[model samples]
Target: MLTSKTRLLSLDAFRGFTIAAMFLVNNPGDWGSLYPQLEHAAWSGWTFTDCIFPFFLFIVGVSLHLSLHRKVLADHSETQLLLQLLKRALWIFLIGLALNLIPNFDFQSVRIPGVLQRIALCTALAAPLVVYSSWRGQLLVIMALLAIYSFIMLAVQVPDVEGNLVAAALEPGRDAGAYIDRSVFGNHLWKQSRTWDPEGLLSTLPAVCSVLFGVLTGHWLSAKRDIAEKTVWLFIAGLACLAIGQILASWLMPVNKSLWTPSFAVFMTGWALIVFACFYWLLDASPAIHLKNRMIYLMHPFIMYGMNALFLFTLSGLIAKMLGFIHLPQTDGSQPSLHALLYAPIKALPVSAVNASLLFALLFNLTMLIIAWGMWKKRWFVKV
Candidate 1:
């Protein structure tokens, strides 16, 4: 029912929702003070905030399937299309690297693995398969990726601090993934957590499977099935995934976002599918025509944000960094960063620090909304 040029309103709305959540969670007025739901889980276990990154990656997989399928249908040569995908992936990775070097511009100690870099890597690896492989083949590849990652995590032995190569446990800074990252990138990893990188090379294997799961969902949506039938199947698949992921988590691995564990990938994919299916039903499948129209209108701001997701995401990161970089002198001779200065108004509110932080996040998202509205008005979309 959809075409290359025909915009899927539900997809846009879902993407917009994820982008808004990401901005709100990432740019709290105070990192030291945040609502528990807005912060990531300490090590393991899932939270509302933990869902944003995986949601974005899932959207990426869906977009890739639709876009690449469109290209194939249009008679684009496989060689030409692959080249374009590769170039886009390269640019995304370079942009992520450039963003890391901002403010300090410190090349020697810049973190190599990051959100955008991981997205780029996953896109580069998954795009070829999504474009070329059958649905069953893609499913097999997804299973293979997760299986490989699990084997490495459970079976690989790493030398401990004392230089004894023992089977690595899932401990902070000492996990198999962390050891591999330290070996590969050395000190050029997440400086805050020097011993490990959450988006490290080994962990990216499961992350790739996460995207592949999205590709599978996209292929299903694109199939010539009734809307109700599609929704039912998506629901069924989500439940099965959730059950499988839980079993894996309990027996073999833990569900960890940082590690991109196999169980985590499967669990989050289930969530992604259910959430997207809900959106599709509410926005696209509703029989009430007037109500559907009203719902679409109500979601205009989110649709605007969704349309220019990458641009807004990158711009927001830059703005947040610059705020940290610039500081103003205070009365006591101490300097407060721009972030603190902006937080002054919210800090004065008669609320708990966490509640005040939540207000600040809402205000920040309002600013993004205005910018997105302007872009929407002008039909300005910045594509990568």
Candidate 2:
């Protein structure tokens, strides 16, 4: 029900940037030698890559808020809206589950908690709360969720490596979240580290706060304030949250993305707000600055990508899987996947291994861009 006039170009642009960044980071030709910024933190810290997933989740909240507002404006019944949102969430989660079964289709070790699954869960949990609560109530829910997660993480105890049930430690494998993941998923967690999964169950509780942060920002964006005034206040609010997050991290918890630590959530939320504010100021707030400028052309590809994000993300994943499935025998009588074959040449580039891997990812993103452009031209948008 959102018309052209109501649509926020800044939101779409930001979402597109996040999707594009995700594609680039995920599809790097060689994971072992990528740039540090592109790689996730080994355990406790964050890289630019760490921000990508949470940014997407936050965008989901914004999209959900806008969609629900449109539904309310259309006079849709709560039952109808609820059913629709539930169906969407379940379908997306199933898609995530199905993605894990790709060329191998091996269910025995398939990952349960994943990017799309997290999105589905966040949206499902946040939609009802947003619909039922006032803005003040939503703010309270955000605070309460963060507080409860912090307490549980700090106060709860589970057996450590020494066979003692004690308070959760801040280390990777020793944390309470890891214990829950191992208990529930058994051998079905992320294979990279059997001891823990980044998208585990307990960590997901704080991730919900990431979505709620977006929900609150969405509400603020749609408020009846003057555009410039809103932009200024958003900047101020973002800086304040950044300070608060830093203080909390320094005093109570380490800002860790894998844990989806409460401080990390607030910290990233601040970044998201500032980024959105900049986009709004440049693209939506000043019509002359946006439309009459040559720079507008640069925004076209990103906007197109945003228009059909879910489809592109899924297709990209499937294509990556298929590419890895096709194998060819090398001159040394060793079999290598198509991806390896393609990357082998890039590997010979007279540059750092990181730059070579980055080039491969850029090539993959270009291919996706072609598909996205085609979809945009045909006005075919696939949404979940």
Highest TM-score scorer = 1
Residue-level lDDT of model 1, residues 254-350, one tens digit each, is: 8899998888999998898888887887788777899889989898777889999999999999999998999989889999999999999899999
lDDT of each: 0.87, 0.84
Where does candidate 2 have its weakest 10-residue lDDT segment?
287-296
Please give the distance, in angstroms, between residue 80's alpha carbon in candidate 1 and its true position after superposition.
1.7
lDDT (Cα, 0-100) at 139 in candidate 1: 91
lDDT string for model 2 (1-384, tens) is: 243248877788888989899999999989888888998888766789888888898888888788788778878888888778888999899999899878788888888888999888887888788778877887898889888888888999987655668785878767888888888898888988877888888888788888988888778777877878888987998898789889889987988988888889988888888887877777777657645244346777888888998889899999999889999887899999999999999999898999999999999999999999999899999986
Candidate number achieving the greatest lDDT relative to the actual structure: 1
Q: Candidate 1 — worst ten consecutive residues by lDDT sum?
A: 159-168
Model 1 TM-score, all chains together: 0.97
Clashes of each: 0, 0
